[model samples]
Target: MFTKRAFLTLLAICIGGGTAYAQSDPLPSWNDGAVKKSITEFVAKVTTQGGPDYVPPAERIAVFDNDGTLWCEQPIYFEAAFALDRVKAMAAQHLEWKQQQPFKAFLAGDKKALAEQGEKGLLTLVAAAHSGMTTDEFAKSVADWLATAKHPRFNRPYNDLIYQPMVELLAYLRANGFKTFIVSGGGVEFMRVWAEKAYGIPPEQVVGSSGVTQFRLDAAGKPSLLKTAKVQFIDDGPGKPAGINMIIGRRPILAFGNSDGDHQMLQWTMAGSGARFAGIVHHTDAAREYAYDRPSKIGQLDKAWEEAKAKGWTVVDMKQDWKKVFAFEP
Candidate 1:
C-alpha cells in the first residue's frame, strides 16, 4: 500500500539502524556502564592511529586470568574438581589413600579436612592426580573430563560456564590487533588442553604453573614426555609477573583478573609506561554467579578490591556490568 518513495525511505532507515547497531557494540554481552565505557575508550585510544595514546598493534598485549575472571570458580576450582575426580577414579589402585589426610578428606567430601591440608595438601593432590602419565595421555584425560564433566550447579559442561562478556571482550581485543594471553594460577598443561578451544587463545600464549616433565623413549622406540610429581613453577601471586617476564617476554599493557592472586600482575601492567588498562572482575552476583570477596577462601578479592578503588582501576560488578553471564543463559 506504500508508495515507492515511502518504501525506499523505510529501507534506508532499517539499513542505517543495522549499521549503527553493528558498529556500536563490540561487547554486546556487557551492559552499558562505566566499566564497559572505560574498556572501549581505552581500546579506542590505544588503537587510533596517530592519536596521543596510540600504541602499535605489535605492542598491544592483553593478559587475562582464567579462573573467576573469564569463568566461574565457585564451590570449588574446576582444576581442583578434576584432581578430586582423578583421586576417586584411582582410589582402587591406591588403597592407602583411604587413610591419607587429603585423600581421605577428598574421598569423604570433607571440605573442612581438605582445607586443613592447605596448599601443601593441594599440591599433593595435584601431583598424585596429574603426574605419572605421558603429556599426550594427560591432555586426553583432561579433554575427556571436560567433555563429560558437568558443573554441579549449572549441570552443563564445565567449559560452557565461561563468561559470555569475557569471551566477547577477548574477541573485541583480538579484532583490534591485540594479542590476548591467559595468565593464570592453574596448571599449564591442564589449561592448555582446552583453553585454545574455549578462549581462542593458543597454548603458547598461556602462562601458568607447571610440573616437571621428562622425555623418554619406550621399548618400541616411541618418544614421549612424562609428567613428573615435582613442581617446576607456581604462577600465582608474585609468580604471575615473573611468569609473564619469563614466558611472554613483555609486560602486558592491559591486564584483567578477579582475585588478590592477580594483584601483582595488575600492578605490573599498570606500572608500564604510556596508556595502560587494568581491571578486576568482582563477583557481586550471588543469583547469577557467586558473590564472594574478602571472606571466601577461594579466589579471595580483598586486597585487590581495596587497591582497585585506591588506584582508580575499573572493577566490574558482575551483576551490574554483564547483560549475560553465560552464552547458554536466556
Candidate 2:
C-alpha cells in the first residue's frame, strides 16, 4: 500500500541502521574469532546482574604485563636498550670506563662479551646507568628518552608500538567497570612517568621491579629521594603474583600477559574462586612484528604457550587474532 519511492526510502533507512549497529563493536581492532569472543563473553557474564558469575563492580580487577604485553619487547627489552644508551652517554664523564669489564664490552659494542656477564652484567649496566639521580630527575630522564627513542626495526617512537587490539581491549574492560593495572618487570618509576598517557593507567596502579630509594633533605631543605643501586623487588615470574598481592591487595579476576614471566600471574588469577579469565598474547607475526619464543633470550613464551592450551587460557595469535597489530599501519 506504499508508493515505490517510499518503499525505496524505507529500505535505505533499515540498511543504514543495520550497518551502524554492526560496526559498533567496542574492540574494532580484534577480528571476529574465538579469542575476541571469549573476552566479550567473560565481561558480559561477570557484569550481568543476577547472573551466577556476576561480580561486583569493585571486584572487577584486571592486570596486564607492560613490556611485551602492552607494547613491544622484541630484539630486546626497551629499557635494556635505554641502559645501553646511558652507558654511551656517560662514557665521556668516566674515562676509566674504557678499562671497566662490562662497561668496556658495552662501549666497544661487543655484545658477545656483555652476554657472557649474564644477568649480573645486565644489572650492573642498569645500576651504573639508572642510579645516581633523584627520583624526579630519573623520571624526567625517562620522559626525555621516550620522547626521542625509536625501535630499531620498526623505526617508530617506542610509545607508538602499542598493540591496537590490546588498547581497545583495555578501554573495553574499563568501560565495563574493571580496574586495569600494569604489572611489569620494567622499573616502576620509569613506567609511571608515561603509563597514564600510554595505557590510561595511573602511576599508583603500576607495579614493577623497583630499586631502593633514600629520602633526605637537600641543601635547599626540600625533601627528595635518590634512587640507589640496591634492588627492592623483581616483579617477574613468581614475583608477579607476589607483587600483585603486595600492591593491589586483591587477586585480579582477569590477567593478560605475553611471556613466561606472566605465567605465575595468570596462574594466580585462574586460581581465584570466582569467574576468571587469563590470556596470553602469542607473538607470531614475524612480518609485522618481531617473533621469537622459547629459543630467544627476551620475552620467551615456551612454558606459558604449552600451559595456555592445557589451562584453557585464551592465546591470542597476533597474526591471526588481530586485524591489525600496531595502532598505526606498517
Best by lDDT, which number? Answer: 1
lDDT of 2: 0.90
Give residue 2's error in model 2 in angstroms: 24
Candidate 1 has an lDDT of 0.93
lDDT string, candidate 2, 258-284, tens digits: 999999999999998989999999888
Using all chains and alpha carbons, the TM-scores for the candidates as numbered come to: 0.91, 0.92
For each candidate, the alpha-carbon lDDT, in order, equals 0.93, 0.90
Report how far residue 53 has shifted in candidate 2, in Å: 0.4
**How well does candidate 1 score on lDDT at residue 144?**
89
Give candidate 1 regions above 4 Å deviation: 1-23, 108-116
> Where is model 2 poorest over a 10-residue stretch in terms of lDDT?
14-23
- Give candidate 2 regions above 4 Å deviation: 1-23
